[model samples]
Target chain A: MLFEVTADPLHPQPLIDHVRKDESGAVAVFLGVVRDNSRGRRVLHLEYDAYPEMATSVMRGIAEDAMERWPLTDVAIQHRTGRLEIGETSLLIAVSSPHRAEAFAACHHLVDRFKESVPIWKKEVWEGGEVWIEGEPVERS
Target chain B: MKARVRLFARLADLAGTRETEVELGEGLSAADAFRLLCQRFPELADHSDSVMYAVNAEYVNSDHSLRDGDELALIPPVSGGDRAV
Candidate 1:
């Protein structure tokens, strides 16, 4: 499937292969990686969770929306759940189209919408403690 | 009537369980189900106003109607990470 929520670590090459085709002239990929720091704290790792059923459905919707908005040949979105250490790939978004502009726009739209709509969450494990990220109150840090 | 409820992230931590079976009366709205959940797990009351509701995996508002056997979820503000997954 092009849209997924996997506990396994994500590899971008396969998604790139999935979207690559003869008619497509441009391919855009966006990878979200786990960094070592957040808000000045040293992040040890990240733990991701999802309401899987909803997360997959929402991700597909986002991909379809991108396709409708752009002249895209294919869209693939994959997200990782469970724990990921520093530098690991947490998200992969690939879009391919006959032109660079459409591929690039769709790839950007998919990632932005996924973050806003998908039911996935991540918690940053810092040196001493862990806190949920995004949309949560600053007090949580 | 009855409903199955799912909690995630901070809501699940506060409720102490990821899933629960709730008893509800007929014609009650999603709001009523959330209110009853808060009673069962008082820790969730503080977020009653902030948390969103989902029915059968679809996002819904508090006014949405509830039915027997429906799967409901309590969604905290999503934490989709920023700059550092």
Candidate 2:
């Protein structure tokens, strides 16, 4: 139950440690890194924006749903906002279960649902232009 | 009544600001408030189909009624987590 949305850089180790349990025989983790290229653009940076209050609340809900849908022993999710450098981790998803199948499925499920509904956004800046990845067309101000 | 409208992403860029205050008639729905926004920022109307409504940080239906002093967020098509392409 360690869901959060923050503006600080994210690390996977602490989140992985949070979900580890002696009873759990398996652990699954996913990291969404800020890659350097997108849609044929050259290497650059990215900016993530989120409605922090609602984003965290929605993340918690997604984690709860993942727990209910799978035999998960623990769940944790974190998303970073604001400026992010290349190779930085923007998202960390971890889940623990008694078996590998459940852990894997739940971790994947969290990522899918979190992406589909979370009130967060990714802005891709590469070369001479930038765009809000999924929102609108490219136009620099 | 007055309701504060919050914009994000492209909508914010179109509006030239992230938030604004709008006057709403009694019993008017959040969707109606958006219509008012369109009157001020017609460019936003271009995205009417993809917009989503959030009241006080919680997702709600467009038809959801608004009250005085409510905070309504106009969520554009959220750039989902996947940036790999």
Candidate 3:
């Protein structure tokens, strides 16, 4: 498993390649990109920041949870921090399994859980001002 | 006991510093420490309801107990792109 929180744009292809193996017949990748609009506002860009230690720990927990829930051969999650422009890749998730169904399921679950759990925050810089969005604390099962 | 309190994003900007060492009475709960912090930084009082607390890198409620040398992070609102799923 590989997990990272950095300012660099995430390249999903490398992550997909790394998880591909002879025993693994399927790989699923998910990419999250920065959009130009949010809540009716024209967003110029986004600035992401995180409590690194907490974010990483939460991510690791998410990965562990994914592993337990699915028969995944490998998993990689990368979330970008700092300034990001529209169309820039913000996050990437890759999961590999012996079959396509499991790989897709695990990859989707991993990304959803990560978003709901991770401590990384995004600041939407609109044409007029900016707003900070935080995740609601959900009970971890 | 002395605990380190770290602020992130908007909270850090409001506090004007990233981290501070706070000395609390014995057996301080997360709530108590937060109240003391709010007293020191009045601006935080306005957003206390929205702020979230993390103890030792894990999100916790105000009722959570504090330990000596614990790392406390005050998380303000997150302003990132759509959550990846």
Give the alpha carbon lDDT tens digit for every residue of A30-57 in model 1.
9998888877888899998789899888
How close to the true structure is residue A42 of candidate 1, measured as C-alpha lDDT?
89
Cα error, candidate 2, residue B28 (Å): 1.1
lDDT score for residue A117 of model 1: 72
Estimate the overall C-alpha local distance difference test score of candidate 2: 0.84
* Model 1 stretches with alpha carbons more than 4 Å out: A136-141, B81-85
How good is model 1 by TM-score?
A: 0.93
Error of 2 at A120 (Å): 0.5
lDDT of 1 by residue, B1-85 (tens): 7899998887888889999988978788888888998898999898876777789998887889989999998877776534333
* lDDT score for residue A2 of model 2: 91
State which candidate has the highest DockQ: 3
> Which is superior by DockQ, 2 or 3?
3
Candidate 2 chain B lowest-lDDT run of ten: B76-85
- Using TM-score as the measure, the top candidate is 1
The C-alpha RMSD of each candidate to the native structure, in angstroms, is 3.5, 4.2, 2.1
Model 2 TM-score on a 0 to 1 scale: 0.92
- Model 3, position B30, has a per-residue lDDT of 80
* Tens digit of per-residue lDDT, candidate 2, span B1-85: 8999888877888899998998888799988999999999999998877888889998888899999989999887666566342
